[model samples]
Target chain A: MPLLSALGGATWRLSGHLARHFSQTARRGERPGGEELSRLRLDDLAPTALSAGRLELLFGLSPCLLALRAARRRVARLLLQAGKSGVQGERAELLRAAEVRGIPVLRPRRQKLDALCRHQVHQGVCMEVSPLRPRPWTEAGEAKPGDDPQQLWLILEGLQDPRNLGAVLRSAYFLGVDKVITSRRNSCLLTPVVSKASAGAMEVMDVFFTDHLAGLLQAKTQQGWLVAGTVGCPRPEIPGSSEIPITSCLEFLWDQPTLLVLGNEGSGLSPEVQASCQLLLSILPGRQLPPGLESLNVSVAAGILLHSICSQRKGFPEEKKRGQHL
Target chain B: MPLLSALGGATWRLSGHLARHFSQTARRGERPGGEELSRLRLDDLAPTALSAGRLELLFGLSPCLLALRAARRRVARLLLQAGKSGVQGERAELLRAAEVRGIPVLRPRRQKLDALCRHQVHQGVCMEVSPLRPRPWTEAGEAKPGDDPQQLWLILEGLQDPRNLGAVLRSAYFLGVDKVITSRRNSCLLTPVVSKASAGAMEVMDVFFTDHLAGLLQAKTQQGWLVAGTVGCPRPEIPGSSEIPITSCLEFLWDQPTLLVLGNEGSGLSPEVQASCQLLLSILPGRQLPPGLESLNVSVAAGILLHSICSQRKGFPEEKKRGQHL
Candidate 1:
């Protein structure tokens, strides 16, 4: 008993120490474990002394090799996290390719890695090369036109945590979302933390960064998109009270360019964003969702929402193949 | 951009200094933000000078309130961190609560409170009262039995980080997981930091602690239970192949006592637990299912796995009623 409480107390003190340390390190623009190496800024990282090679992040050694082969003409630098050295002979071969390309390999020290990128478990390796710049919104129509029935886009409003942002991005990719957009001021960039968390999804997704979210959303709405803001309160159109029936939501997706908007983790979607949207959908909190537990981690909430959406789209075909159990 | 990064860096340094200061104070077992007080080991905290009508913990109003509520039966002393008064209605009410209970509210001199609480987020009060007893495994079992179809449990295997454990617990409760079971040696207990992150779920949850997990698990299996370890490569019967519908896998739960086991966040589940389990499940990563991004935050992974299990149980019926879109 007393021993347990004391241990508990010590644990609290240790975490506070750690969180405070990381928060401070982040503010100083230095890695956590590094001794103030340089008073450098993000601007200091600009293409300066040399054109650091354009690195493309791969989900695993296999994709990395394929990517290395496809983009061999443009390759300059290849980097992998030290922790992820377990891939088969292929990863070793990629290392050999880097050796052949005369590309300098950079492995970030674990403890010093930025918490955001480090928290996402990026399999230890991320490329720092300039990525394929996302196509302009107009050109983004190539994959699935704004009018396509199967298209899905994730809209984030005031999600402050980078881990949450990264997880949301990863979830978006897993469920086959076409694109992700966030308010630049309150959102995180496709940093190493977000990249790692996304499990290299950052390398592939069409992530649009902007400060003018309201304007961009307004344009999206004008293009015949049905924007639904997930909120705290229940609405008739929202499927299950506690859990959304994503299949139903997806049925409406083919007929409409669907934009699923989620609000901040602390507060639900803002009223300003809510009022401008076509519908306000919510996952009811059981028969009676308590006020404190009402809020869900933005990423967890996004997973449920995206899963519901995908289940509706994909689960439909399966249901038809096999008659309903119930 | 440079200016912003510089400013951010400054904030990080300042935060680090504060964290260090707190850490040193904690080592000495002093109150938060107070001068060097006497050092006390874990054993010294037992029967810590409790007096009737008084609660003496380093100052902060929040702790005062919590202690008051926790020690309603015989709280005798109220110790406020020095120079921590004259806030507003909420803080002022803290004093009133102590006075109403006839607790001898003592105002420690400036820095004394800091020394006592090791200078963390004291919020104004600390108390000396009866220790919190560990809820037995049987009691935890009754909170939500392992066999309940709706019940969700997080069985952690050798997870070392308190923050990750705390985050997973918070995710479990928010995502409707019934309880979290962890080996006593390998896990951290419910502490102030965890309690804060959990947003009070710790108080409500029945966290079962065990010293021998393998033995406990053996007992569970003896009762005809199913253990699903979240590891193992793709198997035809496993859901990792995507060929195994989530609904079918989950339907197996109706008649069996099911346990969803989670392993170390960075490392995969240990071979012992994996070998002992009846079935092993893995989240298929990618459109084609790749490797690196295959790993997920234990908490995030826990949320997804629990969601997958619960969804299959609850979602199938709901889907049938809505009628298949196909």
Candidate 2:
């Protein structure tokens, strides 16, 4: 039955006028963009934010063997909530895979699916978690460049929006960034909204929170990391200037570690941090790389800069060899 | 007075819980995302489909702007009055820009923003725009090797989410990609939702649409352009491989044209497009790369790719000669 009809008492005709009215009311309440979630009670939800820390996702349309192919140690259980008209065909294969993983097969009630993810879009299955064993910063340093090459890490200063925070994480992960050091205040901690927004990139990132961002940059610079702050104002040419192999500059790591610092959404980098930067880069948009439009969202700007650095190092020798030899 | 105060007189607290339940009932006759707007007769408001002929946007914020902006020649405004508010600040700028260029902005006010945009948040501003203006496929040939390029463009395939669409445009403009192009069917066109998501790039970009994407790709390829696509499955050994400096490979397009094509959100580069590609590369996430996450949103992916290409070209002598070099 259509959700619309279920709520009505009598057979109501959806006169175009009435439908028009209904839609307008709905639109007013809707927030612009993806943050329009109706809040759910933390208690009723079987998954607490605390417990969710241990979870891994098994999401896809039916037939892809991603969930079922996981090793036992890697997965804990499979969850399906597709009622009597339950999962069939490829989705069944996924269930079998979960069984093989020795993961429990849990079937949630249909209403529960609505409860799990506010929107009724969780197609059939989800997974109970197998905790991700915590790792230390040194272990997280796997992203560091070898051969005395330069590497890039990002320091996020006071990002408030969860979606923006999530976007930065996703950008950092895909762009070969080493790690992200974020400020504890006025920042969104990793949450479900962050997870969903990141589209599953939340798993491998190394995010640590600290009190002072400026101090961290200073300390890292002392340890041989070239710290560059993304500034709002114009400045000198970035390191290596003309013919500066961006990829090489990014991978340069200056025999020292490298840290790229970003600031708040509305405000650009903090004055203190800007003063501390070895190179204050204003990623201009054109030939005379201009200052950003009155303001550029921090996360969006971060993606632009990170991509620049990571892209420089995109296909080192081997891939080129493969492209050439293949 | 706050909108909530008006509701309090009706015996309801304005808390989210009450709002949620109230929404369920009051929304029975309401639209999906906003307030119930009064519908105006067709005779009262003149409207069209897309201001650009490529998108179908619902202008429901300020109808006056709709009247002012949707008067372009090629633009057709479809008013979603089924309760519609016309245009907002920056988006109005696009429609207004189109109007200035003699493109007609349409104003059909019967449809609601929700109906036109499904459940996506259009912010009461929707547009039916022509595809972004396509650049001559031959333009890439103008860029020389080692010349810090003056202008850059980004080409994408199959990016779906409007937010990603908006974000990519936002980053592209901020980072300096002058234009953007994508397949008509697989890509989301510039709608009011996209304009809002873009923060303002929708107005700045020369976005173009094409029904036959392969033809566009073929045209560019024939123009001596090097097209690279990002592929990160099996998580390559050489992450960020596509970013390295290949003076040898780039020399081919140093004075020629270049186009970096990003594949779909999840399944990047269709096999067909990949086969047609000059290079298939991947951005290595370093050790910080997430375990199961496949990729970043398409626009973000493009941001990373375009930034790398542009940054690399900056190192060349030609780019520096063009102007005050960064």
Candidate 3:
């Protein structure tokens, strides 16, 4: 998160963006309403000290409290609404944890906290902590042989919804995904709402940020890794749509080191991203509804796909599998 | 919707509730804050009128537009924001359709529209249409034998969020479920927010309402329907934990007449509701996530389960099945 640290692998441009983000987020309540504020670039935030690393502010009770108690990164400060004197239950435990850690707890006015979170659901709490740094994309090359499971990485291309991205992260981590890679263009970054949506999965998930996503995917394909992209079926009953030849989640190859690409929420995969995919996969609709009625929400699709892929990888005894009514 | 039609099945109890709704929604800007108003029940609604079987006043562009285009039931009146004629594109088309149908169009001021919607997101349009009537539970018995696919019904118990209920409805209709039944207690009813979230699925979906939901579920069980309830597993990797013998969704019996019951978003199935389910099933975690690191959002989970069950019902070519990835 510091300018110097990012210089190690990422270009100076990313560092400048990070510097700007700290400044923008620090200037609380600069805007009257913040639907636009949550979708801010790193440059928007005001600069804060990154003694341990880049300082990022996280909001809402779950993320803040989770970060305070469980995050490996340093929780630099805790922010609470003024005159609240700390809430009961989980909130009280958060305050206690902050006290135990000697972290400063600021009881700022509700308006200030509201502005900081851009009027999103903060539930009257926030936190400043070390930035969650993604492992270098190049690290995949240096992995020791046989050290990891068949690598499964998720490449999110142009996912606009922060919550969707967060939900995917939760599923990805839960399903034992090796890493998550976000395409630099048109992806929601680590925002407070995204953190809350993940229910703290944001803190521990292994993530990789990269530019030139299509090119990188192409390179990975050349290296013999299967690059599978998700193509949403408007009607699952009709699997072989006009645009792409799609395999159901049940058919997706599990033995290979694979990279699954999820595209923008509205549009399916971009032409470039789709070209990089060795196979295209989708969730087949079971019961045919009216035309255009069977489209699955993207995050739900991700969960189903992840479950399917993960279960194949961990082939436990068939007896524990119970009766297969399918 | 002509008022005379509603004179059929609904008791005076519903009319009294409808009357209350009109007055409450009309008291816009009445609440010092609108959060409480937004969460009010139908019984809490201030009453208006049911003339000629029409119960008017819906909100948001999609529901109003969708109502005009596809709604089978009566859509009595369309309300556009004042000073803004139904402009080009979808809104304009909606206006033309209403004109062709001889439905009156009123352009109320935006402020009044906001008040009527309780400051919820209306997107500058509202419609006054008769509320969707729920098919009686006895109608399930009258369902023609062997004509439809093995019947699948969703029974929602105690869902608090209107958006979640609406989302479940969208998935239900999309996945080709036969009927949706909601407990009269604690479930968010069909509201404008719900309609918008469903993208207008609320208008056409077959819904049944029952006051004694537990009793009805029991009766359905007695009638030889396999009532399956969803039980959330915090750790899917370690199932059969003291609670119930949970089966994977893949193992869910699709051949039987099934009624899947989903419980409150926060809590799993209640004791009484769980009692009705002959089988408790869940989507197992494919990978072992850290403790408390993995819980699927209820709606996302719903989409996944629905797709899984639906896909199995419509088995395609065995060759296309492409080897069990799971």
Candidate 4:
């Protein structure tokens, strides 16, 4: 409700002026000259827009086209590189989508596009759209006990990097995770950078957010869901750490519904999250790693872990099909 | 030999003038102010140093420290952000390594460091070192027919992005791929950007390059090596594609020494490379994918594929151990 209220307020304010300009430009069939729009800033138009926080400027060909196709966000305007009006294929498809939707298509100079995206690769396309708000976990319908036992939900705890979060979401979606839930606090909110990094996967995926991740895990456990927390490696060196049995991801069998928790980049799972987990999963290095090279990047690790667990599900190819049936 | 010759020539030339200034500054205990060093460019010092092609500017604490410790390249100088000289921990360790090796240390403005790395994240530390040259594949020793049956070598064919190349290398090294081979023709070279992206794994991993990747695969196939090439999916729609047996990566058994070949980001394996592969492996998506989201990122795919194949090796933990033995 807070997310919806905030988004509604921001969108209402933004659409008042910017949306009017966009529709007028489209109706007049006038392309805004680069010089005329050089000093235009989306934040300036929306006074409360906190530097890419309130209104999102999604860029790149995939993110732009997918954002339009998904229709998840309220797109205000579409900006294509000035000389790319005649562009075919995906860019053309994007133009047609905007036309059909009556969204203004602005052919801005590449510099304006570049400045708009802060020099991130725009692929000659940028979109001014309402921020895609992640729904609160309370709004996510709970899976019944009789629901698919092979379901897997990815729980990300305190992931700070947008690119890492984006990559993780891409992998989670591609691997067919039943759901992706992240701690709302201290986690990277859905952003343009995340969208671009995800190759536009963020546009399509419905990610749920919750402040009480540990409580959610505990509740799910009572509903016959396995809570699996990821650790870089088992550390027996720390006293009393051996209480939680660590299973190598390859050795762990996926036989039931599960919530797989991934930790932040610098630190592993928090104590509360770790305490709620029934199992600890680790990816064993193939060989002895040198100091400082011991851990894989958080995103890479997520991809590996997701693949390992998801591939073992009942949906995999016949050869990998196990005794467990749906 | 070409790689070595190029590296030797560049190192010798860099050591003449720039190396002297670094040592003199270190010896005199004088810090060059930002204004005096603002216009200095590594390329300006060496006229032929084609913008980060010859002399490498390795950055970030891990890559710098590992490069120094690896002793794989000639360390010319170390650059730490101004006022960070008295820092402790990893930065201090880097300073010590430079001091012990008589590699002069320079304290430059953050802007200078940013410019040197093309605004890439340098983590307040940068190093001027001879490029770590990847040896030609021909220089790599031939693996005999009776070599370890569990050996897995990652072969990359024409990966274009340095970040992708770096990520793959980091995974390869972390997952314990016996060797990493790439086509020298179109593959991203071993650059500092790669080093930083790899999180310093590039400093320790020796990547072998060859012009004729297909010919090498053919040669390895003759040596009782199973050549496994990756495809996005089995496309029975493509005429005559059914002839190449494409197995799900989960179902593929790693019974012998294998060469896993990953292709370029855009277009996968070339016909020549595909023809040389005895088996095609694909990661099966968990569900029906929407259009434009069918394929995983090349780097992400590599991680998943590598994890799937590597985890099945005989060296895995007891639970994952199979009948195959050393």
Candidate 5:
């Protein structure tokens, strides 16, 4: 009944002022050039953040069986909830995938599934996927020179929140970032909370895990990617220290291949990582910021910065055109 | 030991490279052009997110006691965990505030505090404060005829996540918004989770809650405020309808007192709200978004829009000034 009401509401709105609003013009169907759409479906089964330590549980029939079939990581087992709606399609597909992988499948009552996940909401279907392992840079073939200089690479220094990780990844993937490099030592490890927060972008993004961030940054800097890092501290004035150039996020230019770095939530940058950055970028303070409330949430900051760079790179001209429409 | 370790780490880091960074510039002895610094300590008692009914629990010594003393809302009770350190100032202050208000203060074991909040971290202090009640629009002086036309107002419709609510409020407050308006029917209440997520912004922000959002919007429109709303679907193909101007968020002007409305996390503006908006704004899409992921997280999208408008209103002389620094 609720779903019916929601759809009814959506339809009613679509026929009214929204109809006029959306009829302004046509949007170009072409995705501004990247991988072929053919491989888009292959990433629907990302598994890194779902399982924390050992076997992880994935709920919902489509996400589980899809992950079993398409995830880069392997599945160890499947746990299907007994007696639920819309199981035949995923059940058949799940059985086929399990047979192909030689994995085990178990049918468990809903209550049992609830017990295993500490009373988390597991929507009918669940799977025991392999534990998360950090992906090596070598797996993506970007380390030994000749990598695309224009490729966007982000180095996250010490993000703490799992939800922030998911949000940033979704934005990064949407904005055409090539890959992400993060360290687990001073950051949130990929977990189920992160996967759910990502709303499925975790399945598609290319993330390389690292322990030696400063060292890798030095290497990347040596390779001539314009190394930039974000800082929120309003200008720390060192009497004798030379000023490094800082770019406002609004006016930042993407003239070269870039490696953008973000600092921890509370602490902006570790001294070592701060030393590695050649360019400092900032979201610039707006008027009347409440004390102790100056900086934005880490994930929100990421979305804004990624949007700025991505739009510039695409040469997407909309502001003036949109102004004209107004 | 954990508290000692956390403080030790904070102090140690505070003196190192962080010292050099902070010592570079001295903060203004005054908190800019706002209230006197003498009253700054009053709001330190905000509770962490916990309550959904009549009262909520605020954890940590400073936030709980200070909230008890200074919050416009009443504190029903204070829960003090036995066997914790650093209670001299806040404890003394808390007891005084409770006596003045005739509220009870309970000294409970740490286990009891944990149980009360469903196993949330309490940091040895907790308080039950009054539940949220709708604030009348008259409190902020916006409902009057001669209110400042340059004041900024916001309307949020059907936001579901307490975290997003908190994040948006923090950003809105930091960016100099005058007040916020939200409806409760399809929205997350001002619960303890939201308070924690907001990092205490909820205590200070001037939020006017409304039951009849459409009616209030209509009234505000009649009173002459430039009203706008955001949509993310990116579909510009509703047939048989005439064109309506859509402003890209980047170029949207903040020339007058404005009321910006953001809709539901998933479904976006109900048709009624869409009809009410004189202008429509969108966070422009970047290239090659994942098949199922096009929109950014709500809080992130809010941060970007609020930043844009706030910076514009401030007329921050950036482009060349920042370019030169670059």
Candidate 6:
């Protein structure tokens, strides 16, 4: 009973229906159309379904629920595991949202749902929704010299990992970043995996993209915005690196509108992008690091750097107002 | 040629051997014992192989390399992909370490290597090594009142996710935490996945474990070490609250020995554990969070909190002696 309670009463009711359905399918020696559905791949559905504007199969409870709530994309169908009549909480809310929007809700077998999501942990929910695309930087408006000093925008150049991108977005949104821009050229797009990895932050945040990252940095610099590129622990051994002055992230005060640039996971910021920055920021390790363990994960680094900069914002709690000091 | 150079000269040499192996296997209508090896599972060999002290199949280039370098456990065997004779760089280093240890190395098919690691990017290497067990808290030694003023130990209580544990270890090591202790009960173990997720930090860092987390906290508190527990955004609306005064992590100065406690992912610190804290630490969000987007990922929070606390340690660069202020 405690297990049932932990699982929730709705699951208890749904279990009976699921059991009955499984037994019925087994007895029939066929799963009706379930077998065919379970083998369906996203690529196979690309030509027709995606062309019809249902671009992605967004899965997971948080992503699906948030996607529906955000209403940024059109939800063509909501796929719930068979026998959800007794479902409650978020799943029930998802169903209601679909109903309010007149989106068709389908009760498919769990196998079919699994196949639709490429066997991701969907939590008994998936949706056929339009892709959430990043807007161009041109639409992000010009940065004037008199812009808010506390404004911070995160620029990701050539980040290839979807999970890292998602984690960065989650941190950016949570840390109150004014805008997020990624290099359109070698950046991971806003895929469903990214949505799940972000814990659904991707559903709410508006990300901008640009093919010309270095140009944007130069333009922002000319517009009186500080462009700070992140580099790992100072590699003074590298030739021709002494020109750019790198400051410890903690020592660098955020007193003006700034663009913080993060680079690719494998190879860091390309030379052209690094050259466009007016300043270079680096996180100093508390102790000497082992050979291969020199740098922090990009997402973790982003979180630390963003927290350091954003905490210095004008209205941050208990800091400027409360006169608290470390 | 450029692609081959980027992949390394060893890969170029290994390609012909791999092509020959694949073609030979295809012509033979068999995989030459690889079929059975590919089907092998850890549980299937637990009764015999583990009883003989071969415990875990540590995979990934980093973990395998670090495990070999650390020599912490008795490595039973090292399995490299069949065509690795032509491999250089880290792979060559790994082979040299194995040879130095006099450990047997097997040249298995890539499919078998994949199966050994459950298909989680083994990078053409796998190792059958003894388990890396956490030491008891008793072995961690007592915290004297006159102990180093800047000592910081990360205490993880009931952390369930392997990846989170790994990420925390990676951050803890990178940030230079003095020691890491975790609750033995209801915690994820140091599995291969954890090792891989940690970027091989688990192979090098010595983690301590305790059955009674609260007891250890109380004992450490009595020894003049501050026990600080992390909490989410303050809930002024909780019915029976207000005893613990949570300080902003940024505002909390780390001038003494401290134990930073992080709770589980879903349900945070258990009630009993929360009561054992001398102080509570909370990271202030930069802006108002929407519903369900309240907290940061645990590992990211760990990195931020650890960096904040660790940055204040005595002799930290650019902080104490440099006279730099944010």
For candidate 4, write residues B248-293 as lDDT tens digits.
7777788788899999987788877887878788877877777667
Model 1, C-alpha of A235: deviation from truth (Å): 12
Model 5, A250-312: lDDT tens per residue? 777786778889888777777777777777777766554534556777888888788777767
For candidate 3, report its TM-score.
0.71
Determine which window of 10 residues in candidate 4 chain B has minimal summed lDDT. B1-10
TM-score of 6: 0.81
In the range A295-320, model 4's lDDT, one tens digit per residue, is 78788889888888887887474333
Order of quality (lDDT) = 4, 6, 3, 5, 1, 2
For model 3, how does the per-residue alpha-carbon lDDT over A201-252 read when each residue is reduced to its tens digit? 8777777878788888888777667788886653333334334456777666
Q: After best superposition, candidate 6 residue A28: deviation in angstroms?
A: 22
The C-alpha lDDT values of all candidates are: 0.51, 0.50, 0.65, 0.75, 0.62, 0.75
Q: Residue A179 of model 2: what lDDT?
A: 70
Higher lDDT: candidate 1 or 4? 4
Q: Write the per-residue lDDT of candidate 1 for residues B1-326, one digit (tens) a residue.
A: 21112111111011333345545666778654232323332212212232122222222443345445444325545655557656466556657777787755555554544444554445556544432223545556542244364555668887765445656665666556656787766565544444444544444555777777767677767765666676524334423333322222223343445777788765656656666666665544324334554455566666556656654445432322332221
Residue B156's C-alpha lDDT in candidate 1? Answer: 82
Candidate 1 residue runs with Cα over 4 Å from true position:
A1-94, A106-139, A142-147, A233-256, A286-291, A315-326, B1-151, B161-163, B188-191, B231-257, B281-286, B308-326
Residue-wise C-alpha lDDT for candidate 2, range B1-326, written one tens digit per residue: 12222211111113444344444644476432232235432221112221112232333333223323433313444333333344555455655565566644333333433444443444455444433334444443445434533445577787776667777777766556656777766676554545556665565556765566667667767755566555655323344544333232222232335566666776666666665666665554434432345466566556555555555555431222212212
- The TM-score values for the models, in the order shown, are 0.63, 0.58, 0.71, 0.81, 0.71, 0.81
In candidate 6, stretches whose alpha carbon ends up further than 4 angstroms from where it belongs are A1-51, A81-89, A108-119, A236-239, A318-326, B1-51, B81-89, B108-115, B235-241, B318-326
Better of 1 and 5 by lDDT: 5
Provide i-RMS per model in Å: 7.9, 7.5, 5.5, 8.0, 4.0, 4.6
For A149-208, candidate 2 gives per-residue lDDT tens digits of 557778877776656776787778766676777776666655444544555455555677
Error of 1 at B156 (Å): 2.3
* Candidate 2 residue-pair clash tally: 107
